[model samples]
Target: MPVQRIFFGWPVPAMPPRRIAVLLGSIALFAVITLVFTLPNSIPSGPSLGRFTDHKISLPKLPKTFSSPSILSPFRVAAHPPPVLKNTTSGDSKWYSNWNWLSPFSSSVTLDENRSLLPPLNERPPIYTYYDHTQKKAADLKAADNALLLTWRRAWWAQGFQPIILSPAEALNNPLYAELQTLELDSTLKVELSRWLAWENMGTGILCNYLVFPMGAQEDHLLSFLRRGKYPKLTRFENLGHGIFVGSKAEITAAVKTALDNPELKTAKDFISTVPKETFQVDPHHESVAYYDPVVVKNKYPKIDEAISKGANGLEILNKLIISHLHGTWRNRFSKGIAVLKPEPDHMSAAIEPAFTLAEFLAQCPESPMPSSCPPNRPKCSPCMASTPLKISTPPTYRNTSELYTIGTVPHPFTMAVLSSFRDNIDVPWIRRESSRDPWITALTKEVSGTGVSSAPRIIKFKEAVASEHGTFHTLWLTAEKEVPQDLDWRFGFTIPRNATDTGKSETPVPGPERRPQPKPDPKNGPVANPDDVKKERELLKRAKDFGQARTPAEEKLRGAIEAWNLADTEAWRFARAFLARSRVERLKWEEEEKHYVGGAGAERGKSSGWGRWFDD
Candidate 1:
């Protein structure tokens, strides 16, 4: 045996020097391979494909009065309550319960078998009235009811109210919004009839008049009788908006000053432009005077006048003194002196006339689809006598005035306990029509949906308001130019109503603010760049952005190494030498590191590098 030694389980026979060198090299290579597999050192995920390319990337504000967020926002989204089903009890009211469209009269749903569904938004409940599929009449609403709802939604419109305009007129350099509605209400609730009455001692053709209905025991009896399929109204009295007007002493004084200063002012638009939007709800910074604060002013105004008043804000004094303006004295200023700009005759014929008779509608019965089953053939019954009686339809007004008028059920804060105790008995459901908008007017006018301008409007010109006995030939209404002004602030509900679209086909309505049109880009901000440049810039930006978001030093190093390796074929020598040097170093380290596996952890501390490993202690 030529110089043999047993260093491990097998006998290591000393070979020739060349063979020994080869065996040593092979051992070192195996250790390097083992270290590559066994060591914790890692080169991330993408670049280590033996080198090449690796790159990649990756308010809780509710609108309006719904200001607060839900408690469950941190976890799962809170389940929205289900919509009211027909004939269901009131307890199951859901988020969309207020969305009473497509449901049977929700008013039929009773609270504790006594109350009606016609309560405040907070107190209203699910509808219990079922419309049987077989009942064709139930399936189809009386055209009059549709017309009434249509009209009711527009009840507050008048030339004197704040004018909400969609487009500018060619006549004058018209402001987009006409100061139309009187922000300073000049009428009191105590008056049953209007102070602006157009009649000779009779409240006929009143502008900006309240549509009062019988309240208290009278309202209950009528509503109860209505539930039993009876008359629409027991009394001739009807519900209305506050027969409101737009003047106060300050308003009148400023307007007189503006008028006196500018003799050329002829049109309402000119007068309106001069009135400040700060006087009303149009100012976003504050709300309309709180409903109750007016009372406190009445009791305390006298006491303040009793003393030499300090620098008490005059604005508050005017706000308080403004209360007296609600009397008849204030209304005379508008009705007698001012000439109003009004729409041409409103299409009230449909609302004023009954579309069908009781027997006529009932004739839609499967047994009788013939004309004989309709009106004329059947004995005429009063429109008010039918189940879907000619309910109080709203009189025609302008496209909802710019004023902060809501066309909901009347006398919200009931003055009498009778009106307040309405929930004590079963009454009709809250009408789906709150006068927010009229779908019929929408359909009839063929208004371009998003644009406020009517595409096929019947009336083109606005006529001046005429006195009651003046044998009026025309009615004044708002007119608009085809082009909507770009800079003008449009009013009305900024929040798109989450109701079903007029297109009847969509089942699920989206919930959120309606999307506004993209504003035209300003050239001053930045000129439009070439697409190719944009794309190149974007790519460069992506590279730069990576440094901030995700790229690590190790990753950058690995990426650089990969790029170098991939480009090595053309300029190979430097990279080849560098890689070989690193490989050799790694190989030498692993050779001694492998001894730790064979001889255990203690041996690692004792191992050496280069030729020193041959003398490990």
Candidate 2:
């Protein structure tokens, strides 16, 4: 036989089956040992959006030194429990906890303090505006405006509304944006067109049946006016002064479709005019301010026009103004210190007051000796950080919390809001209460699991119906029931600690979560790990493993409940993606058919079939 030459580690000649098998076995054994030893130190995976349910659930190998605690044993706690942190100002820690860090829910009692800032879900109107960074003039104008955009957002946020700031780049996602790109319209006209197109995109696609408004950047709606419902309600299409128009989803979408059909309507203003108006009903009067020269209005209000005719001063004219559209002309006068408009004390709420006064903002400018840092007395630095609280009165309806059946509609905002609030907050690195359980957790788990049934259904049986011709259903739920417990027990154990904290410096660290100290760098020996520290870490890891291995009756129940809801929630997201993807494909197909009918020889036949009848089907 020819002498076999070794290339690297293996012989050049093919090894015997027995030898190869033995080598593979040895490698596998080593991997198993390494994984077992390192698993305790490994971090749990973060939350993922898609393909959550289909993935295989693997149980992590227990550490070599891990001692399985008794089923009745309690969780291991720190030797010394950290002192309960107190608020000196309030003298009660309960009030601090009530803030519900970044959560969208609040108690009915604290509604005014928390949920008062933003309108509750279904009530919050989207204030749409456009910005063009490509234009030098517009860029310079916005840049020099000194936090005008920030102030504008705060103004809306204060009134419980979130403004949607769109740009030409953002509009690229809209299918209609392609048409805008094809046309070479005037830059100014294009800005207007792009804004409407983007708004139409949002109204039709995301927020169906929702009312949306387009407002100028410089324009500000009085908080009092909005609270009092003074803003114009459009039955068809009504201009609410200062070029602001509010319309329903159908009306706006119809207008945009008309624009796309008619090539003559090039400008955004033209699209607004295309919006169907009620011929019978008269247009409402829109208030305008003539505080300074060159006052412009969409429809003149008797009060404002009369004041201007009587030669009313800045303050007098300002009082009568409901929505102040301080465009370039008004802003220019302010910049040159030519015009001054001030409101009375009672009218303060009625005016478009920013989070901070202009004087306070100016004091903290870069030119000041002590800049960049907020003044000790002033807390205006971190504006718009308040959470948009949930409307407790409107709990998730039965449709959303219905389990065992697919609803085809997404989970209610209330259900989502509750999930967002409690998911992170309630995760404590401690044992479940032996006596009583949290009502919120019990309710939420049920809601989420039920919601998942509708939102994320296991459509494996019906795969052929919903599945695209080319691709099969993306992800199906895990078939085996045993996998759930193993996955939850091995992955999260008892609880995944919340290591994050709020912005307040004086606030105490989140209780129960331990932070490991990093190894210090030495001059001669480079980074050196302390043997004692390493030993301590191993002990802690062992203790943690023990705590997880041994679960109380309550803990065991809690773990199972958590696993059930979590799996359902994961599946819900997975199903939603597959469902939406299928819908998109169907939409594209319909659009193709529509194009063929519109442009092809079958135009008359398609019209006879009925416009948009296919979509309804």
lDDT of 2 by residue, 179-284 (tens): 7778766675566667777767666221111112112212234323332322333332223222344555666666666666665655445444544445112334
Model 2 compared with the native: what TM-score? 0.27
TM-score of each: 0.15, 0.27
lDDT of each: 0.24, 0.32
TM-score of 1: 0.15
Q: Under the 3 Å rule for N, CA and C atoms, how many clashes does model 2 have? A: 4
* lDDT digits (tens) for residues 1-617 of candidate 1: 45567877789756788988998999999999989897755655554543454753322556655543454346646454334444222221121223332112222232221112221212111101011112233212323222222121121111111111111111112221122122222233101111211111211111122111111111134222322322221111111122122333334334334433343333223223334444322212111111112233234344433321432333233322222121111111222111121111121111111111111221111111121211111123121111221122122232223111111111011101111122212112221222122222332223223337542222111100111111111111111101111111011101111121132233334563245333343332122333454444334433333432454676455434332322211111121122223223333343354333212211213222232221234
**Candidate 1: how many backbone clashes?**
21
RMSD of 1: 38.1
Worst 10 residues of 2 by lDDT: 488-497
